[model samples]
Target chain A: MASKIRVKNLYKIFGPHPQQALKMLRSGLSKENLFKKTGHTVGVHNVSFAVQQGEIFVIMGLSGSGKSTLVRCINRLIEPTAGEIYVDEKKITRLPSQELRQLRQKKLAMVFQRFALFPHRTILQNVAYGLEIQGVKKGISENRAQAVLKTVGLKEWSAAYPDQLSGGMQQRVGLARALAVDPDILLMDEPFGALDPLIRKEMQEELMELQEKVHKTIIFITHDLDEALKLGDRIAIMKDGLIDQTGTPEEILIHPATEYVANFVTDVDRSKILRAKNIMIRPTAHVSINDGPRVALRKMKKEALSSIFVLGENRTLCGIVTVERAVEAVKNKETGLQQIVQTDIPTTTPETLIQDLIPVAAAAKVPIAVVNEKKKLLGIIVRVTVLAGLIGGGENNNNVGSSAESGNNVKESARSMDHISDPLPTSITGMG
Target chain B: MYLRSNYRDFFRACSGLIEGAVNNIEALLSFIPITVFILVLVILAWRLSGRGMAVFTLVSLFLLVSMNIWDETIRTLALVLTATFMALLSGVPLGILASRSDLTENILRPILDFMQTMPIFVYLLPAVMFFSIGVVPAVLATVVFSMPPAIRLTNLGIRQVPAEMIEAAASFGSTPLQMLFKIQLPLALPSIMAGINQCIMLSLSMVVIAAMIGAGGLGGIVYRAITRLQIGSGFEGGLGVVIIAIILDRITQSVGKESPEKKAA
Candidate 1:
């Protein structure tokens, strides 16, 4: 969990007299107050954040909120008026031109929102450009570029010019170009913002899968809240050149520090975004596999349940023992519940989206088993809990555990259009 | 007086190289027979432009040869080519400087404006003053007259490259020099080619004007006809200049009009 990239006290002022404006900013003047006084636009003011190694840190804001400027400052594409940006060990803002270039080539890479491809070069050549600049030999660079092209699913399009490709294909080439250098930190300035919604979603998913392998620390900039929630390991909401809040998606959804963020989450569909972990009930009527069916039937009867889960050592789900099967097994003198247990019950991971579990839930006789990677039962996601979560019944968080561990208490769900009109958070207005 | 002497000495030092190049080109072009030279130009024109332009080059050069102005026309061609080469050699570096810094652009723009706007005849005085009356002065004068367009367009071309592309190059850690060569120059090549086309045309026009300082060429023939008022010879020399102009214009204009894709990597 070491910080791969750390930015400290970053400020970007646009116009003449930035130092003067920065002084005003330090004195607690708002962006509008400074603008109204000095007529100089503030880009990013007094912003700082650290990204853990291999984390996708998304910076989201409306246009003109300086999210793009903040990203550019990390790589020095847009110089900050005052700041310290550290990519790994080097202080990028203090580095001389040669050392800065070394940092850019060796430690960091960028995927531009506009693709920013060399229109003249073929896609392969464009992808290889970073390596070529780093003085890698032509044959080796081309091979590396070709391999990265395959990773981004643009292998066959390598010979074509960027202009010849469609926008999505062009963006794939852009991603390949960034990946070709194998830099540890990727500064993505709304890389998928220009793509159509379908392609953007595919790229989001592809990036998620790709991150599992490449594990590069990425600082992604976007204006889209859904994209922020979907891709960000943690998200920072920017406004008027200042960070309003930074937290996990669930935190931003449930405890929006400002009304703007609440308004953003208030419209997000809960069923699609909420996972099994958010709704699963804790399993109580269960027994170890060593127990006999006689013991199982007694536990089931004591819990007032017809069926109970049978778990092996380490709480790995063995199967289920129905009261009828348990009774029959006991009458027949069966020693263990193994003969009576049925192992065909449906199962899902805690992270499985509720929408993904609908069909599985519809056909199941019992609640779906929410298991971890080793098949240890984490909890049970009963049908009614999923139904209640989708319907925005925040107080109806029923099932195994009554611990309301998830909600930040913002909006439970956007089941009806009325949630859209829910009062905007007053915190953002109070700040302005 | 010392400054003038030093200036003269400096011009004297460089004149041999220019003198040698001009003589070499003139000798090479004149050595080839009129028919062979025209045929070569026709083939080259065909390759660069198209068949129609090739036909025009062929017919025009043939007419100049039949007018008995072949050697003079070749001499003018040599001077124009040498001057154009010199202009590009010197202009591209200045263009790079102008593109890299505002200070250079500010310094070069006014000088470039002065070079381009002054009448062609005025430069010959300074050229003759420096090198004395010869092909060197004429070639050097033509170089001066032809250089501005190449330099200006090269500056403008480099400046016109998309900022995003430049950021991409810089973000990849391209050194200033590397970015200039790999990104700026290659992308700016089409505009550079167009600049060269203008340079060539300007040099051709100046080659005729440069003849006043004792340069040997079709320009000299045109000067002699203008002075002596020999009607038929005057018309013949004028025809020679027109033929050479058409041939060069067709070739360079076609090249300038070529797709940037063809010029780019």
Candidate 2:
């Protein structure tokens, strides 16, 4: 996919003589050191990233970390002292003032941390402001603004001023105003930061739901890690005006690229971030449906397991059969495993979060089967693995091994279901 | 000295232009029948400032009529309104300019301070020397005296518009002019209106001082009363001035408070 926005080697130094400060910065002076020496604050330092079309790219940092400055540089609200910014292959930093304004009008819009609705304008008028400034006629612009307001669930408040609305509702108006322009990209600067925790979560979920509908390429700024993890398709972690890491939420959580990133991720609740796929191990033993109850009994005994998964053609999970059932079936002289197989076992998809999987793991008599959308058996999550995944240290290594082992099993199971599946699920017991 | 000697014709031309504007406004005011004018003011006060102000405007203007000082009061009203109008016309744009640039603001601050703090008498001499004793010089001196608040308040109001709001405006691709008119000016309306109210009151006060230069109005009545030691007519003239000041103050004050959108909410 083509990148909707790309920033390269961007630097924004806030002072009269930024060029001189830029030289000192490029020559390896630290942000603090340079500031002390020349009274120049480095707002963004050589930051670079690309946002894919329709991706929610979050820039996460604490206060004064340059995330806001960096996002502003994308639209040249704060002119970058040095760097290249390209949107739709056009160089933003080099665009003349007229073209820049046109670009801002047509391609970019922003939502502020404080819901910055115009106090003097009605909600509809505030929402229509972007289109109004673009010279869209009042009648047409207002119709579209009304539609956008309806989308954000603020249609009733259209005739009211911003102060009449609650903070959450006002932010909905802010979101409506941004969407009213139909810009290809949105620059949100800590949009939910000022809201109470409950409202922030509600807004975050609403934003995700809205994103699913709009699919605009978004550049979200936040100081909250959980928000970043939840909303970001990709996240760039910024520290002291430089990017510490840029990766997907899971990658950042699982393998932080720097000590700063690692420290940052440490306090994050892993139960929310880790998924069934991250924790599931390759099943130790299973017998194809073509095999008889004797084959199931032999496999379970060999693995010293109480139960084993029974697979149909293409490794489709048919059911699980306990050793006692298999033994009883063998004693009854049953030729097929169908009679003995129990299909009522718990199952989950790979994307289910560990927090969501805990109850399913606790209540299951047999290990939970992790299947794909096609119901193809991918792996299983034993009780111990779920516990260990929640406990969360050294589990990253286990996760890596399990995923690698599962990758091999998918091919191996396709080639030969009769062959034993190695790297026992019992190995997870050692973690406890 | 340099202005008087080197720019005599330029000063005379400016004085001529101003005198024409003041006379035109005075004539326009005179064109309105006294009953119609009072009725319009009463209605305006009622709508903007409530019933009490409307009654006050009615009773007070009738008092001026009964005192037989109605024409003088109307002349004073024209002068004050003309001065305020000119001050706003010039001051608002300068304030907008100062708001846009740091250097302009820094340069304007001391100049505004000087204009506001310098005594009325100090500038009256310059006004007489330049425009030479008429409503023109009176209007000019009043504008100078009353203009500072307009500029200073406008600058302060625009500057005080929340930074986030400005960013929001910019992010939506508002041109500089659009930002000023749509966001900054609208948000700054109350402050600008306060500035205007101050300008009107200052212009009213300046009118009496202006009477010393033969700018005829209620100020002339008060000045003549004072020179001749006629306490009765002087009190009547002073009451007329007070009534006009209160009426203007109440109306403009209400204009700032009555933002349509906010009122709707």
Candidate 3:
């Protein structure tokens, strides 16, 4: 995966004599020593991370933990003391002010927590603000803004003042404004923090739907761990300007690396994070549907296979059979298990993350078997996928195979279907 | 017979009001030299505003002396000081009362509006009917004409003190009086001083009109100069009035400027 943004050892300090104070502080001086030399307030300490293209990266922390400041540093809205920030292979932090302005105009746009809509402008004008600043032609910018506004479901309110709109509507205008410029990456700082709970949920859903379509790299700053988990492809939990841990939500939740991370994930429900793949049995030679009915019955009798995946010629899911069906088919003079198989069985794709599959599977009280587009039976999974995923066995249990596949085919099929069936990942959904 | 009866009752009431105003004015003018000496002290107060303002004060005093009507200037000053003292005495207390009670504020509002909008010449007519033409009548007209701004501003200033500061003071266990003195008054001082500036300027302006009713001063000299076609004398007397205006303007402005800072310190 290409790195869309990479931040290395960033620091930002604020004070009356910030530059001189940082100089003293960096020269191996203590706070008291620095005070005697020059005094300043520390805002960001050494922080580092990389966001891959098309990733929903989140920085989670309380208000003063510098998550907002860190995002701003990436955009250089607030300058860092010592750091390197690269966006799309360009060193954004060191860009001259004019070039940086162009960089923001072309590639990056930011959304503020306060919405920061210009009070005097109507919603149409507010949404068009960023494009206007970039000196886009009036008609073109307005048209773009209108299109973006429609995307956020605010087309009818284009003529309304920000003060005339509700808090959520105003925030939609803010989102539309950020979207108007067709930015490659968006930096959002607590964009929904001010809304009521219902509105916030609606907005989060809207953002998720938007991300599906646009797939823009997003750096979302939020204090709500659940929000971070729900939105992030990878979450960087920050404390006092330092990244405590950076990982997928599942990785962080199941095996928190420290006491702080443990406490953060302690309240989360475990079953929700695990899926069928985590608990299902591995494929064996007798698992194949191609085996003759008498051989299959003998295999079932030996290994106690009540039901097993039945794969066709191209390693695609043909269907499944119970021991009773296989035995009945053999006694009735059927040649194969496929002739006796039940065809209407439901299955999930390998991309289906455990956290998302658990609710439907548990409610239905049936294992959602993993399958492919050609109807290939990849593997059978029960309620234990979610459990195993939650308890640190998710990554290990991801290795599921078809009834007909060799080891090579299993690995290849898993790679192709990775994260495709999962509409929402366990790392993100478990926190939600 | 009806007209005669009404006229007799009106005259009787007018005479009583005139007697009261005369007693107050006579007592106020008796302390004239001390008042002039205090005006000089007020000049010193003017100096503290800034060096530039002190320069403005000196120039205005110079213009008054050069007009060659210094004694008349002093008499005019006497009436002005007396009127201003009376206005301040009545207006400040009333403003304080109005500030405390919403009812008083509502009651005084229309009265203040009337006092401000009524013509200066119209005010003198009532004074003349009551006191029948003299310095006492002139002083009464001047005070009534100028008192509104002072009272209005004092009320506004006190009322406009921020609720936060007052709450903070109250939390510290300060009494109502302590809050009024240390917090409200200090914060409101700038606007109150602005009111005083307006009052002084209005009083100086009223002196010229007072000359028409036989209250002699630099205004009488200017009136005589005009009637006798003594253009130079009228010009000089006018210059003297302008000078007095500038000096009073400067001193009141400075007093208004310094009080809040002193309290803050």
Candidate 4:
């Protein structure tokens, strides 16, 4: 797949002689050491990355770690000292002023952290600002702004000035402004970073759902790791203007690329970031609805398992049948596994967070079923798997990067049953 | 001296134009009935400010007329307002330029300091030498004296606008002119108004000193009273000047605070 954005060897220095500073950075001087010695601050040192189309890529770091500087470089809002940035296969770093403006107007939009809605402009005018700058007709721009405002759930606020709205509403107006232009890539610099925790959480969920519908590639910068994990398809952690690591959240949690990343992920609440699909395992033996109760018992016995899940047509999960139920049905001359099957077990989607599954898994008679939208049995989350996911380590190992890639591009996985099938139901212990 | 007397015909031509402006202003203002003039002031004060300020303005102007310096007060107003208008014409653009470039600001700073800090009496000597015993020199001196605040405050206000907001505008690809008009000017309006208010106050202060140069106004009345030692006329003229200052200060201050957007949030 063609990458949506590619940044290569990006270097930014805050003082004169950027070229000399670039040389010093390339020679491996640390940001602090360089600052102390030469008095030139390094913004981003030798940073390079590619964001695939439709990816929510997060760059995370502490304050002054250069995350904001990195995002600005992508759009050339702050000219990089020396580097190249390519967007949509076009080399953008060297684009002429007019061309750069065209790209900003037509393809990319930014939402600021402080809700940079113009105080003088009404909500509708603020939302329509990008279009207005692009020379779109006033009437059309206003109509488009109204529609986008409705998308962000801020209708009836068109005529109100920014001051009349609350912070969250102002933020929505900012988002509406960006979306009104229908830009393909959204550059958000800690957009929800200033919101209260509850509003931040709500905005995170809203952004995720919005992405599901809009399918815009998002570059989100934040200092909050949980928000990064919650929103990022892949997160890049920055330290002292250098990208320490970039990987799936689970990959960072389990196989941290650097000691910095390791220490950073240590505080992350794994239960929330890890999904049921991350820890679930495939049931080795299952009885089909067409098979009799004898077939169910034989399958459970052959696999050395106490229970076997029953699958109907099209891989739809029918239910789980234990040895006792199968044996009793067989003794009574039960015709099929249908009568013996237990469908009372809770079912959850692959995306359900492990924290939400704990109660359901604890109260269940058997393992919880992880099903897809079509009710097809994708995997199973047993009590041990849920417990393992909560206490994350090698036991909770998941190929999240590959699985996510597969999930996004259907042909890559086409029912990627390999996720859970390799590790049978009973073997997933301590994935947490 | 050469321009005023040596070039006799050129001096007459210039002084004649100056006399026409001063005379027209003096006559036009005093020609209105005293009640009508006060009524206009009340209306103007009400429109810009609120009813309270309007009432305050009415009382002050009435005091000017009752104190028997009504014509003299009107004459002073014309001189002060004309000087203020000329100062704004020159000051705002110089301010905008100073705000834009460091070089311009550095150049303007020392000049404005010189204009503002020099004694007001020092200006009268130069005024009397250039356009002896007339209103032309007085208006010119007032413009020089009052123009510095407008320029300095405008520069400060523009520079004080948040750099982030300016960057936000640029990131949207706003042209240089668009950024100035659409962001900087609107945001800097209150400070600009403050600069104008200061200019008006400074011009009014110069009005009395201008009388010594033969520019007649309330300043002339006070000058007469001072020379003759007529204590009664001196007190009334002093009272008239105070009333005029109060009205202008109140009106301009209200205008400076007018922007609802800046005032609200």
**TM of each candidate vs. truth:** 0.82, 0.88, 0.52, 0.82
Regions more than 4 Å wrong, model 4 = A280-360, A363-382, A391-432, B1-24, B31-33, B261-265
Predicted structure with the largest TM-score when compared to the true one: 2
Q: For residues A1-432, could you state the per-residue lDDT of candidate 3 as single tens digits? A: 669999998888887877776677677666555555555666777788999998999998887888877887887767898889999878888787667767777788777777776544578977776676666799999999999999999999898777778999988888888888888998888999998889998999999999999999999999888888888889998876678899987777755777787677666553444344533444442346677678766665665545555666766766666667787887889886767866666677766666576555534323456776666666656433442344343343342222222222233234323532353345446445
Total backbone clashes of candidate 2, pairs 3 or more residues apart or in separate chains:
0
lDDT of each residue in B36-113, candidate 1, tens digit only = 887889998999888998989888877886787888888888899899999999998899889999999999999998
Summarize candidate 3's per-residue lDDT along B94-179 as a digit string, tens digits. Answer: 88889999999999999989888888788788767755777766877888888998899999999987753443233223345755
Specify the poorest-scoring 10-residue window by lDDT in model 4 chain B.
B256-265
Off by over 4 Å in 1: A279-349, A357-385, A388-432, B257-265
Question: Could you tell me the lDDT of residue B21 within candidate 1?
Answer: 91
Residue A165 CA error for candidate 3 (Å)?
Answer: 1.4
**Model 2 spans with C-alpha error above 4 angstroms:** A284-345, A373-376, A389-432, B1-8, B260-265
lDDT of each: 0.82, 0.87, 0.72, 0.82
lDDT of 2 at A355: 75
- Residue B123 of model 1 has an lDDT of 76
State each model's C-alpha RMSD to the native. Answer: 7.4, 5.7, 20.0, 7.0
Query: What lDDT, from 0 to 1, does candidate 4 have?
Result: 0.82
Which candidate wins on DockQ? 2
In CAPRI terms, model 4 is classed as: acceptable
Off by over 4 Å in 3: A14-42, A131-150, A155-159, A212-215, A249-259, A266-281, A290-346, A353-368, A384-432, B1-265
